[model samples]
Structure formats: C-alpha cells, structure tokens
Target: MDTDLSLHASAPSPPTSPPGPKGLPVLGSLLDMGSDILGFFPKCAERYGDVVAFRLGSWPAVLLNHPDDVEHVFVDAHEDFIKNRFFWRQVTAIFGKGLLTNEGEDWLRHRRIAAPAFATRRVNDYADTMVQLTSEMLDTWTPGEVRNAHADMMSLTLRIAAKTLFDASVEADVAAMDNALNDITREITARFSRPFVIPDRVPLPGHVRYNRALRRIETIVTRIIAERQRHPGDRGDLLSALMRAHYDDGRPLSDKQLRDEAVTMLLAGHETTALALSWTVHLLSQHPSVDERLSAEVHRIIGKRRPVFEDLAELTYTGQIIIEAMRLYPPAWLIGREAVKDCEIGGYHLPSGTTIFVSPWIMHRDPRFFDDPLSFRPGRWTPEFTRQLPRFAYMPFGGGPRICIGKAFALMEASLILAAMVQRFRFQWGGDRPIKPSASITLRPKGGVPVRLHERENS
Candidate 1:
C-alpha cells in the first residue's frame, strides 16, 4: 500500500517530482553512469532517497530503489508498464520476437508454447544432464592448474543448454558461439551507455561486429532448425517440444518463430546460469567456512555419487549458497520498464513514456530488507527471513508475469552443478588479481575469475 497513489483518492496538493542529482547540461549523468554503471544506483539512492529521478542524455528517467516500488512496477501495475524501448531494442536486435522480447498476445502465446518445456517434471529430467556435463568439465581440470572459471562455466552450461534444449552437441561450435555472444553483448552494452541516436544499421565498428555475430548465431540456429525439420520426432528436448507444439487453432510456429525461440533459449538459458555459478565459485573461494559447510552438505547427501533430481530438495544449503551468491551479484542485475500510460508510483507522478529502472543489485543489499546486507552469509536465507521479506527485494531472475521462465530450471541446474563440482574439487583464487563485477547484458566478472583447482582426496 506504500505506492497507493490512486488518482481518485483525496490528494494533498500536486505531487512533486522525485529528487535526484543535477548533472551536466545535455549529457546529464551519462558520463557518470558509463564510468561505473554498477555503483551508480546505490550512490543515487544514498544521496537522493529511494525513488530518485535522473536523466539519460535528455530523456527523463527514475530509479525505483525500494522493494515496494519494485513490486508496483513488476506486479501491481505491471500492465501499464512494458519493457523499456532502449533496452528492448538492443535485446530484440539479437533475440528477435521471442518470449523474452515479445509483448501482448504474442508474448502470451509464445509463453504458453514454451512453458511446457520448462515444467517441473521436464526440468527434473534435465538434472541428470546437468550433472553429467559438469562432471565432464571437471574431468579436464588438474590440481594446481589455473583456469578461467567464467569461461569454463560458459562452455559447460552452453553445452548443457544445447543438449537439454535442442538435443544437439554444440561442443564443436562452442568457441564460435561464445565469441558471437561476447561480441553481441559487448556491442549492445556499448550502445546502451552512449547517447541513443546511433542506429544499429549504421556502419559503426561495433555495429559491424554485432551484425557479424548475428549472422553467426543465425547460421547455428538455422542449421539446427533445418536438421530438426528433416528428421522430426519427439527427441524429448525443448526444440522437439516446440516443433510439436500447436496453437489453439491447430497451427504451428513458423520457422522464424522457432528460430527466435531457439536462439532466445540458447542465449538466455545458458549465459545467466553460467555467470551465477562462476560468481558462486568466486564467493566460495573467498569464504572457506561457507565452502566447507557446502562441501559437507554435498558429501553427506550425495557422497561420491552424482546428484539426482530428488537430491535437489535435500541440497537445501547448496541452494542457499547459490541464492546468496545471486543476491550479492545477480546476473540479471537491472530490470527496465517504460510506462505505457501516465501512472503514479511511490507518490510520484510518472508520465507516459517514462523509463523506470529497478535494480536487484541495489535492493538486494538495502539494509532495510536484509540484516548485515553487505556480508555474504548463506545462513541468512532462513525460511522466516524469506517469508517476511518483500517478494521484489530478491528478484535475481526478475518478478511477476514476466519473471524468468527458466527460474526452476536455473535453480535446479545451478544447485546440481554446484554440488557436482564442489564434491570433486576445491577452488582457490589463482592470484592477487581483484575480480570486478561488470554490469553488461548480464553481470560478469570483468576479466574472468582465475582459480586454481585442488582436487578433493576423498573423492
């Protein structure tokens, strides 16, 4: 009820705009934002209260830092807000009109078609594949050998996503796919930070790289679709399910629809989860006690055996660690939505076309909702703590109708993979290099986390 700014209710004078820092003329905080995107929100909130207004170039924007305000945008008045134009343009450029980018009935239809593939039963079935893939990756590691945990994770999860979703082996194409994904993410991020006038069609260096990446991705997806078409059957994977799916009117998705959905799953389904695992490993390396407890739990539960789907429920502490890691460094750190109609939120009058920003990175660490918010304490995720907390306070995968469709899958995948890896190897920071979090399409370690692997003797 904190944001119950109903227009019909009796009001006390006209509502004033939220307070924020005044920046340089025209550019308007753009330089500061680009300098440290991750730190910008908390700085604004600390200085100007939770609901702070700012400008992205000349466009007016507001950062909703409180969980209740986040709830209003994501759940209560969600219908009035749609994906922000700036962010969606970049996402749609790569993902096309898939579930992640589509809106309205198209979104609903696509959601329905894709929903079955990620059902509880289906995701549980994928747990074996998750463990299998993680174990395969671990087999290549040697004690005292340094590795880029982020790259290793990206490669591992990409393969799992490919096999589980498409019943295809992307091992041969992993390098190509990884390079393309990196190019696209880098290009889009660059576009996001700069002024908005530059079109993707223009022959900017980044744009050219982005288009090339797009072609590479299209080639991969197109090849997969063509093969599936040639010899179609229920392969018991997402692509097969999508191919078999039919609308209420008995029509099927077009080849383009299939391609878009496939590529969306390929990009989103792997990258975010891999980043989560990488950060978890980094955090675990720093916190030895937490790591010890996690190892103990994994050994006690699975003990020299691969984790099964049912083991996920009993791996409660492992789940807590992943949850806490995401809380500290959520892969999807920021959520952007634009007002479709003039609306009031947190007592501020936001006109139509206003860009609304909600950041999990800031809200997750807000002292109001979390005790010892800056500390990395997996024990803090008790049932009582979660029950009392606002739902939006910890949206690592987002919230409401558009909440990540792969929530269950990501959790299960992360938990299973964490259990599998931690049971076999102990990771330590390879050197004194400080790993910085980069706020791009997903939160990633700036250079990549370098870690030395110490094989567990008992295992």
Candidate 2:
C-alpha cells in the first residue's frame, strides 16, 4: 500500500511574491539547495505549496509543480521565455553553438537540418545497430560475473551512437571519449551549485580538465567532419545526413555549424538513452516480479529472436517498464527556463528574468497527479490514464517545441536495448549500501548500477 495523499497535502501561500520559505537573508537558499538539491525543491513544495518562490543566491527563482504552469512555460507562453542563461551559459561552454544551446532562427535552422535523420522511418533503420551492439556487449558478460551495469550500458550506447553517427566502429576511441565526457560533466556539475561561477578562462584545475576534455571531443568530432567533407555523400549515418543537408538558398553549412551539430548528437544522443536503460536495469533488479513479467513479455513477443523495430509495437509491457523507470528516475532531471519578459502563470505575476524551474523529478512524483507516486508501477500507463493526465505531468523528455529532438530516437533506442538485455541476462543486485542518485544536471547512479549477472538459459 502507498502513503495516503491527504497526509501529504498542503496549500499554496498567498500571491505576495508567490509565497515560499524565506531563506538566509544574504545567501538565501544557497546552502540549503547545495546540500540537497533534489530533495530541497520538493521539500519546499511540500511545505510552502506548489508556487514556491526561492532564491539561488541573488537570483529570484520559483518552483512550479502543476502541469498547467509547466505547459505555460514550455508551450503556451514559450516565446516570452529563453533558456535560463545562468545554467545554459555553462552548458553552452561545453555544447558550443549546438542545438542544445542555440535559440531563435539559428536553433530553427539546425533543428531543421538534423530533424530528418531522426524521423521514425529513418530512426527505425538503426534498430539492427542498436540490438547488434547490445548483443556484442552481452556476449562479453559472464553468467556469474559481477559488473557495473550502468558502465556497460554507457559503453554499449556510446558504441551504438558512434556507429550510427560516424558509420564507423569507435571501439578504439571509446575510452578517450568516455573520459572526456566524464570530465566535462563533472566540471559542469561543479558550476551548477555555485551562484558565483568562476569564468572558464581562469586556470583553475577543474577548468583545465574542462578545457582538456573539450579538446579531446573537438579532435574526434573534427576528424570525422573533415573526413565526411572530403568524401561527402549520403551514408545513412547522422553525420552524413547533416553533411548532405543544405540551406534553401543553396548555401552549405559552415564547418563550425557541422561541428556543433555533430558534437550535440554524439553526446546528447547517447548519454540520455544510456541513463534511461541504466535506471531501468537498476529498477528491474530491485523488483524480481517486474523483471520476470518483463522477460515473459519480451520472450512472447520476440520468441527467442532479437527485437527489431517492428517488434516495439507488440513490446508494450517492455515499453511501460522503461516509461515507469524514467518516471522514477528521469535522466534530464530538471529544466530551467528564464522569462525574457514579465508574464502571468498560475494567476501570479512572474517578472522578467525570473528563472523558473520545472523539475520532472518533482512533478512525476506528485501525489496529486499520480496515485502511490512513490512506487514503481509500470501498469499505470494505460491509454486512458495517460489521456486523463495533463500533458506535462509525466514529461521525461520535456514538453513543447524545444523538447528533445531525439525523442523518437531515444525511446526507440532505450526500448530495443532494454528488451535485448532482458532476453539474454537476469541481474542480481548484490549490494552493501543501496546505490544513491548523483544528480548534477542529469540524475546518474552514483557509482554505477553494480550488479551480478545471471545469464538466462535458452528457451
């Protein structure tokens, strides 16, 4: 049984400054948020109510828990908002002028160029590659071996991303890329906590690692872009697709533009899907009944064969398990959008430059929107249930036009990889202390989902 919803209920404060906990006078919620960022927001919502106002140092911020308000910022009134510069400026340091950082027409053009490659028909073509890579990795796993499933999923997804993007196996290049990404994410996480951030030009040791990581990424992406330019043709990979794209006036994309799009796809494409699968694997290990049900579904639908893109339709239960896991542990945990102009949301005044945070982590677990929100219940995702819920209530990929472009690509990739893994191995979570979430920008399993593998016998 779940906790009673009535016990957790609270009322919103009056419209004066969108009522919330008034933290320390000078530093505001800085210490509190820094100590426990994920738990802090919900605690405010629980006590101060839905439209909770808080501060991240001098910056005025608000946490909007309801889906209608989420819709306002993400969709209905998006034109009046921009990616919160406080956070995205740091992200821009890593992503450059990629789709993730670009806004307005520049963003539109890049999105237009890259969109075709991720179209369902086109994305489905990579199903074989997704499963093939998973199979290759599974072949390396020993039945009784203890392994970091998160690391395994990360490596496998990176391999798949490289093959699908570069049309070459980057197995040899994986370690360098992996190390580079690790350093980059670490540097960015450090930046997020600090209200007063040190400029990247400063030769701090962390900044040095940050710059070195950028160079490594640049080297690999540059090599691939240069090669593609020298031999430009449609190769059915993402890079080739971008290389083949042209502006309406017949102008070709600049080298810098190519670099931005490539790095964006290479990093964002693999990381999110990898995290989704990692969490799903972790959740399945914790609940054997759920795991067994998932295996039965995969076996029934796939029948001793690997899953193809077509099988995704019949793999409904497999899809639900992944969906439920994401609801429990969203990869892109929080989204920050700053208002460019004053606006009204939830019948309260939001002034210009207010950074509004709409966290999927908090919203997905709201008792008002979901019954027994704390439990891992995949079966709740029925058509009627989804239809009844507000659109933003369960947005793992986010909402609106600026939503993740790789949405189709990601869902397909996660589902296929998850289905394939269960078909081959059963995980046993032999733990000392329970694995904890290390949420910086994305929520990751702190150390990794370390578990012992028990290979499934052939049917």
Candidate 3:
C-alpha cells in the first residue's frame, strides 16, 4: 500500500517516498495479487528492495521485508500499531472481541485470563492427549491407501483442540466443525483480500454459506461452553482457566466473552498446527533423505514407546524439521497491522491509517537472511546459527509483546505429532494430486497433501 507522509506530522525534511512498481491504473496491484499473492509480494521485495509500496484498491499500504523493520513494527513501536482496523472489522463476526481481534484493556484482560492455561507445565499436560488422539486416527488408516494428509491432520487437530481446550470429547463434532470452518474461512479470506471490503450482510452465495457455517460452529461452541459452565471446576482446560480468572474489578468473563475466546483457541489451536504437520508430512514425503534422518531421530529418541512429556526435550531434529517447514509454509503467512499514530518503520515515515504488512512468506525466503532460501534444510538451525540469526528473521509465531501466546504450545504439539507419525509411517507422494500452498487466512495445502501411507517395518 502506498503512503503519503505529507499528511502526518512534519519531519524536519521531506520524507522520500519509497520506490515501488508502477501499478496498472486505479486497480493498482490488485490484479497481480489476485493471480499470485505469494509470488507478487516477493517479486516486489526482490525488485524494489526491503520496503515496497503498493495499493490494495484505494487503501495506502507498504510491505516491510527487513527483520529490523519487522522489529520496529511489532516490537519497538507495537503500541503505535494494532490489528489492521479494516481487516479485523471483517473477521470480528467470527472472532468477536476475543484476543485475536481485541485491543487495549479487553485484550490485556483476555490475555491475562488465558495465559495461565497455556503455561509450559500446563501445556505439557496435553501431550498425552495429543499422542493418544493421533494414535486413534492412525488406527483407521490402511497401509498402501492414499489419504489426504491435510484432511486427516485437520480432523486430528480439531479433536485435539476440542479435547485439550474445552476438556470436551468432540469425536462426533469433528466433521461438522471442519466443514463449517472451511466455509467460514473461504468467505472471510475472499473478503479480506478483495479489491474492496465487502460487508458480511450482503446476500452473496458465499455470504449465505459463511453465515450458515458460523451458525453451525456457534451451535457446537455454545454446546461446549454450556457443558463447561455446568461442570465449571478446575478441569485444566482453557475454559476452566478463564472461568477461574477474575477481572481487576473481580468480575468473571461473561459467557459471550468465554465463547469468543473459546472459538479463537478452537480455530487457532487446531488449524495452524494441522497445517504445520500437514506441510511437514509433505516435506518428508518429497525429501526422502530428510525423512530418513527424522525417522531415525524419532526412533532413536522415542523407540517403541508412546511419547511422554519428558521426551519432548530430546526431539531436537524433530523440532528443527517442524521449524523449517513453517519457514517454508508458515500457516500464518502475513501479519497485517495499521499505524494508530505516525511511526517511522525502516527509516520511512508512515502515516496513521496506513496499512502495514509484514509477510513471513516473503521474509522466510529472503536471500539476505536464509542461504539458498527455498531449500528445505533443517540442519541450518544449529544453536550457533540460531543465536547469530536476527531475532525477527525467523519469527513464525511473530515477535515482541503481542507475539502468539501459543508459541510453546504449538511447537510442542507439532513436534509430538510429527515424531509420533513419522516413527510409525513412511509417506510417499501420492503422484495423482498436486499439493499447492493456499495463502488463505492460514497457509494451507490447496488440494490437500495426498500421500500413500506405508506403515513402517519394526514395531
């Protein structure tokens, strides 16, 4: 998105407008973006350097690709940047005023309440459930049958999310919840990147489907919330944590607030991790040597035992594998924010209301930071290399004060699931289907990661 620093408070000298592609007429870069979002931004960054200017219809915006700039926006001046007002307005229908969309006091309160539930010790409690649920899912897969890894991962993660977050067994609700979520995400993503923001109330076919999906999800969420409230004790679930928490004034989270946070966790907890696992499986299938190394690593660490919480620390290569896959196909691909006040990002002055985009999609592949940026090399993450790498250069969970609170939990979940699955099966690329990355709300495999399952040789 282009910026005119003239509107903001004056600097001692005139701000130099950053160089960018001369977009076509009034439509700007919308047409190019429609064709390939992942390619478009990276091309701009490659051509124009780190900070690139463009337009999403009429809204002025800029893409910041430097790690230092990323640090400035998300860390140094986080208060001056909040969730993009334009984009968040579209998702509030589904996300509500939960931590995903809320700001200031409400966000702080919700974060405070939800924080304890995801504490390292507490998150460790869910490992048994994650492994058990994954094992149960694997029970149904037949050797030599080709299954969509993404679809299976979605189902497995949703079940894990339901059980771990709300302490409710949702074996029956998985299919319905997944279908509903697909519809909702399709419609919201269509709206989010459109030439202009379309109001949700409009009577488009997708809008109808989106609303129906929302209602289906609400019914399921409402059921979970009601069930939790009835058995409202310390169940070691997120809902219990929120219920046990009180506001500064001693009031508890309302049912509405609880529902909002529950849905947020439900979507985030499952979807992103599922994508990460799905992509990891895809990577493993394509890179047989990497797959062999990971298989050996998991076998060496876990070796015929169902994984336990204590085993996580030993899964070093397994952790690196997940991190590398995310670097390539980050589920949360782009981070969008709006400047609430005039701020200098990467030495350029951006005015209030300017849409600022930080895409991990572009950053992860920048040659300046990652060597042979597109290669899938897990070994690049040596402790010395990680320490020497720029802090914001490798932020899959984002950075600074408002970073994803679920970082530890998500990484642990992914490592556990990957280690368990890799140890038991060898995935062969199902040749019939092409798996392409879909940069929707979360980056997902467009056609699903199709792989022929081959159960391993030893126990």
Candidate with top lDDT is 1
Give candidate 2's whole-model lDDT: 0.87
Q: Alpha-carbon error at 431 in model 1, in Å? A: 2.9
Greater lDDT among 1 and 2 belongs to 1
Model 3: how far is 26 from its true place, Å? 4.6
lDDT of each residue in 17-101, candidate 1, tens digit only: 9999897788788888888888888999999888999888777889998888988889998999898886787767678898888
Task: Judge candidate 2 at residue 101 and give its lDDT.
Answer: 84
Candidate 2 lDDT for residue 169: 71
Instruction: Please identify which of the two predictions, 1 or 3, would achieve the higher TM-score against the true structure.
Output: 1
Candidates sorted by lDDT, best first = 1, 2, 3
In candidate 2, list every pair of residues with a backbone clash: none
Better of 1 and 3 by lDDT: 1
Query: After superposition, which runs of candidate 1 have C-alpha atoms over 4 Å from their true positions?
Result: 1-11
RMSD of 2: 6.7
Candidate 2 lDDT, tens digit per residue, 274-318?
Answer: 999989988888999999999899888897888899999999989
Q: Could you tell me which 10 consecutive residues in candidate 1 have the lowest summed lDDT?
A: 1-10
Alpha carbon lDDT of residue 355, candidate 1? 92
TM-scores of all models? Answer: 0.96, 0.94, 0.95
